[model samples]
Target: MPPPSPSPSGRLQWADVPPPLRARLETTLGAPVTEAVTPSGGFGHQLAAALRLAGGRRVFVKAAPDDEPLTAANLHEAAALDALPPYAPAPDLLGVHRTAGWTAVVIAHLDGPDPDLSPASGDVEQTWALLDSLTAAPAPASYVAAVSAAPSAAGLLHGWKELRDDPPDDLAPAARSHLPRLAELEAAWPALATGDRVVHGDLRADNMVRDHDRGVTFVDWAHATTGPACVDAASLAPQLVLTGHAPADVARLLLDHPATAGSPDTTTAFLAALTGHWHRNARRPAPPGAPGLRDYQHRAAAAGLALLNHRLS
Candidate 1:
């Protein structure tokens, strides 16, 4: 059975943007706004919207105030986006605006719905294509340092160690049965994490926009980092399971892909770490502003654990 799909736990809306920030966005576009449509997923932006400027140019903008944590992420995203190679499979960076204590990053908008990841959706092909382009491209020198230097000062690799130390009260029967093994497998991936390709640390249905005319474009590069080639495609496993593919099928699909085909143990340990992180964080208190986050993590944990268990078995 597929796990529940997750959505934004909290997002800042267009209407809620401060007037000064709104005005700055329009001025950056060189026209007044015609219409604004905010996408329904993603917790990173105070404003993640597609805007139609009066003169007919359409662009997507992500903005947030200093108080919102994502506002700080926006700066990193801006730097990363600006440094991404020309052929990188991402939207074009148009402008960066700062006003009224808000930072807004604008990029070309795509005319497509979020990709569908049901068992047989065509977007599955897009997922393959995205990783092919992303993983094959050498890490840009500008982004390598920034991408390689992530601030994981906190123990943030999905907290598997924490989970092993103190299993959650609500752990699933499958997980509770193999807690020790899961912890062991989770420890096996850090050595494999180093690599020359850029990795999008977070990959899910909501992080993509599938425009048939344009193919697929990945957004939210704040989480992008340098890692082994297969890590990018492998990172997508849990999300694929949550959308409708069986855990075994998802594994087979990744195993078949050229970009991810060879790293069986890396994939297993990665899933274990991913699963452990989600399971551990799901039971913690939800952060302020995103009430649905715990449930989302909980469901993702279920899918990741299911995949992890399948691989371990």
Candidate 2:
């Protein structure tokens, strides 16, 4: 059965909830929830709440009647934990509530701040080590069929081509010049396939948290899949720069890491993936504090080229 909801003192007490759902959540929690407050910020869904239980336990509750995006994220995380080597650090999963058009999970609140990718945090070295460990204990090959497949060169090229037909006016010159090369790189797809490994498709700074002595723990598994580890690493190249990792150092390290070679090659398809990423972001409604799309377009494209060039060099 679902874990008893918060107690009288720990019930869901959000000011925003309708009277019916509020009462229902309290009944479900088996306690009068003391307080219910919306979390500060998140990307996927808006109606997220951080419930503080009577015993001082905290859990994230995502209210999306559409589909529990946060719940899906946590499920992915649980799967990744199971797939990772027994020794890897991961969040302690309490349980999940999946009914009432909402998904909530009680998880240990990580004490540390969101990870900073800058050299100050030694993110470059830490990331390298993490990637190395990930590749060392890769998921079974059969998982290839179990998870979503990486974008094929053709698929990636098609995505890039679509972007050209709808190019954002503010695109950087450097990125604009390299759009056509993406298709040429797709031609090399036959050589890029690899045996499956558990990959964290989105390993950005915001999704990872590091403890002083325990190393780093990754979160946000919504994009986790069975793919080559290199693809995972490639996905983070832009994020690394965004987080403060020196691009030059990141390039050097990936080039030296033998494990990275096991991932998809530095192909035009990868570049296309990068371009496509920014192109999509460009279309989103800009929220406050959000950077301009042109910035991401330039950065993503540059990072993609830089990563590929570093690999070749």
Candidate 3:
């Protein structure tokens, strides 16, 4: 069954119901459209609309702005949806429409709220259970290669160096100090060839939801790719803390994993670079010492670094 849908709010926009496309959608969906609006973020210019179609079917529509790569992902997502069964709660692909400059996928809305990511959240067991179910599915060769090719923090750091923008004085010193180490970490790409698991490259809390029994429904397959099971484990380990798992436990599990269980130095450098990358780009500033994703990233870096340093000693 579809998980709960997100709460609807605000007004519709041109992107949600452009004149050129509205007629086609109404005719095809066979429903009166009463409302539409852009959902939050997605790759490129993406918007999701909730519409009351004919026969009282409440359908969700995802539209991508006219572009090459965006069109591809929309089609790709539709295919992935088709391949996977109804087990893990993902948006159901209803239909695909391609225009001169745009591509859109109509899908059945999952009926649930976004999973809370607050510190009090304690749903790791649930999250991991869902992950297990997802991994149990067969992954194709192309899917694995595409996910492995997804943009990495190492690549972004290289771009940042090229741009030479002045980071905040407080941040610059640490970032500058870590630049070499980051490069070193980037060089030591661990072997991820042990498994053929389908992975969600970006499985943060916002992109996931929990059901009435705390069952998980991971959304946003743009980052879904075939890769090492450990990569997914490492990516999700940090999130456990935000969802109420003890950070220590999360770190231990990720560290103990065979794929990630390597030299302390390599692990430290990898974790540091990963968190540093996110902190540098994604996190918003807040009160000093306030706990949030940024703080957690810093701490993960420190812990990984400490493990590395100890091994070196």
lDDT of 3: 0.54
lDDT, residue 110, candidate 2: 55
Best candidate per lDDT, number?
Answer: 1
Q: Which stretches of candidate 1 lie over 4 Å from their true place?
A: 1-9, 146-149, 152-155
Model 2: colliding residue pairs: 5-29, 6-29, 7-31, 7-32, 8-31, 8-32, 10-33, 11-32, 11-33, 118-244
lDDT of 2 by residue, 78-121 (tens): 44544544544455555555555555444544545556677776
Which has the higher TM-score value, candidate number 1 or candidate number 3?
A: 1
lDDT of 3 at 290: 26
lDDT (Cα, tens digit) per residue for candidate 3, span 1-313: 2321233332224344345566777778886677664544332234565676556677777665554465566666666665555564576678887663556788766555667655455565566666666666567655544445444323442212321355545444445555555555544544323346676657776676564543567766765655455555566666655455566666666566554564344445445445555545433574322224456555544443333333223
TM-score of each: 0.89, 0.72, 0.68
Name the lDDT value of residue 2 in candidate 3: 30
**lDDT score of residue 112 within candidate 3:** 55
User: What Cα-based lDDT does every candidate model obtain?
Assistant: 0.76, 0.54, 0.54
Tell me the TM-score of model 2: 0.72
lDDT for 199 (candidate 2)? 69
